[model samples]
Target: MRKARGCFIFFMIIIVIAAVIIFYFIGSNDRKIASDDSVKINYSEELASYKDNGIDYLFLGIDERENENKFEGRTDTMIIMHIGNNGKNALISIPRDTRVELEGHGINKINAAYVYGGVNMVVDEIYELTDIKIDKVMLANFSAFIKLVDALGGVTITVAEPLHDDKSGSDFDPGTHNFTGEQALAFSRCRATAKGDFDRMDRQKYLLAELFRQKANFSIIPQIPDILKILNEDTKSNFKTFDYIKVAFKMMINRDDFILLTLPGESATIDNVSYVIVDPDEAKIFLNENLG
Candidate 1:
């Protein structure tokens, strides 16, 4: 009996070691694509202070559930992340269904930029629409997204309604809910409620903030190897290694400094299609007032 117990203990130790090795390899791989077209880039040209202490990056969640390789999908979620010099951060979520003026496509749903021209095009359209310069971009499709949330040991969220979706195999009750990767995806995709995309945006921001909050635990640091592997495989970012470390430290140090804001716009329809139209004059004022 003593010999058998020793063998079992050794087997468990081996299994644990193997899991660690696997995650390390998974987290270490990363490939970056360089862009040659300068005209398409807009965020880099700014003042020294803005370039140094203050930086802005756009996080784009694309619904490439259909065909990610082909780059065919709508921009399911668009968020602008801004970090101030004092380590203060602000995240503004843009609703997908908001109607706006497309750069070359005239007027259409803002999310349609992905279907028309992929990430670069979508980024350009946003620059034209908002006049806010974006310094970096992070893009993720659905699968990578699920992996990211799950890697974080799932995020805690408030599920307002009993959500049931057959396709994604998601069903959750209303309350403070703990969500796995699949559940988070469903929560982000939900548009059936009374507020529709508006409500969904709030949930996305809330869940993301919660995840950031949870990441403050020192325990997550060791998991970096595994997380980086998943991120390399499933996520795309223009962030350098220092940028990642800086952001992580900032989140840890000043999690409460995160401010939330939505775009200043109203719903309007032109012809037959509905749009979230930003009154240009009013928008400039709002941007200067809030950001400046």
Candidate 2:
């Protein structure tokens, strides 16, 4: 009788392990980065040194206003976050309209990589431009952003001035307001100011930093089950178990360690098409200084 009971428990464990493997593979649909490529990045020394610190990941927020099994749209927002070992961090925002050569697709705006292919193609384009090796991909639809913010009980933000954007339903006074996930999206998407997309990017980074602050202030462990449930519903990722652990540890160390920055670029008309012509030299300096 004891032998039969032990066998039953072992069999159940195998079933559970199979389920988890399937879950991981479902999101691990892109492995093109490992394929033979001309682009070779030398992050060996840096990665070895930072092994005691944290890791790097590409956080892509696609412009899919709704969530479903099928997600297809431009990646409206792109940010690469590098979590360091000594409570130091760096975040670089890539402009959606930045010009880049999409694999198989002709040269176009960076965001369009998603429309042409998927996460793999986007990674390819980013690597070609930055020469940074992204360890993981967090592909999130706009709907997931809302769900995630709400799951954390909303985040607070200070509006600098009065603004109204009927297109995005973003109307606010010059004061601090606790914003829901949907309102947060609208707030970040508003472009009534003189800076236009640059202003929007700043707002996005501010909200993102606030989210980190709030997550740290309030214990997220108890809310993990609930928050993860919401995350799974609207998002997909290729993050491994240790990756999640490292991210949590980094955030716990110091949420404010994050340094927000953007690529230096100017608007230009190329063949009557608009693009943000990035200064490669400036970008290289920023990448080497911050990433190393």
Candidate 3:
């Protein structure tokens, strides 16, 4: 009887080991590009670098008010967050106005890549500009951003002015305030101020930073289902369920190690049409320093 019990335990251990191996391979396979997808473009393989710091992922917040599935719009926000390996520290936020050249397309506004093609085109554009390969992407719509903020128990924002807008139905005095779905969306999208797009980007970045600040609490775990639902209902990604799980685990583990930088450039008008031009030399130096 003792021998039989020991054998049974040994068999269970073997099964557990096999299960773990299967999980890892299955998860890894899901993240790979599917041959049938139209966006699957040929590119050289990029090896994962096991390092002390972490990896940088291009976080694109697209304004998909038009074609949601095909990922069409001017990427209103582009953030390259370098999430460290241990999941404890991070720097966030990169402005979309940064000028860069897209792969197969000549120099143009950094945000134009999305309008020109889709996530794949934008990914290729960033890869060409930074010379750093991205392992994965999180493609989110503006509405999803609002839902994420609300899922985190709503985000607090400080208003600098009182404004009335019928489109968003918002009018708030200058002070510290908490915002919900539509309010938070309007707050982040506010361009009524004098600074226009620059001010709007700054506000959006600030709001997002605040969200990240509160996301690390243990209490937020229970809200993940709602968050996932928001992502499912509003956002679109190439990742599978397991792939998202693995990435989420990695993020939770190494939430702290992150360095965020925006592409440095200015907006201009060529033949009366606004264009964000890439300052080649300055951009090269910036990429070499930060991305390295």
Q: For each predicted model, how many residue pairs clash, with residues at least 3 apart or on different chains? A: 5, 1, 16
lDDT (C-alpha, whole model) for all candidates: 0.69, 0.73, 0.63
Hey, what RMSD does candidate 1 come out at?
5.6
- State the lDDT of candidate 3 residue by residue for 4-117, as single tens digits: 999989877766765565565445435443522633433445423323245555667777776655356788777665554454333434446655666677766778887776
lDDT of 1 by residue, 104-184 (tens): 787678788767765666666666555666677777778887887887788888787876666545577888888888888
Scanning candidate 2 in windows of ten residues, the lowest lDDT window is: 32-41
> Once superposed on the true structure, which residue ranges of model 1 sit more than 4 Å away at CA?
1-31, 35-53, 68-72, 164-170
Top candidate (lDDT):
2
Model 2, CA-based lDDT: 0.73
TM-score to native of every candidate shown: 0.78, 0.78, 0.70
For model 2, the stretches where C-alpha displacement exceeds 4 angstroms are: 1-54, 65-70, 85-87
Of 1 and 3, which scores higher on lDDT? 1
The per-prediction CA RMSD against the true structure, in angstroms, equals 5.6, 8.1, 8.0
The CA lDDT at 282 in model 2 is 74
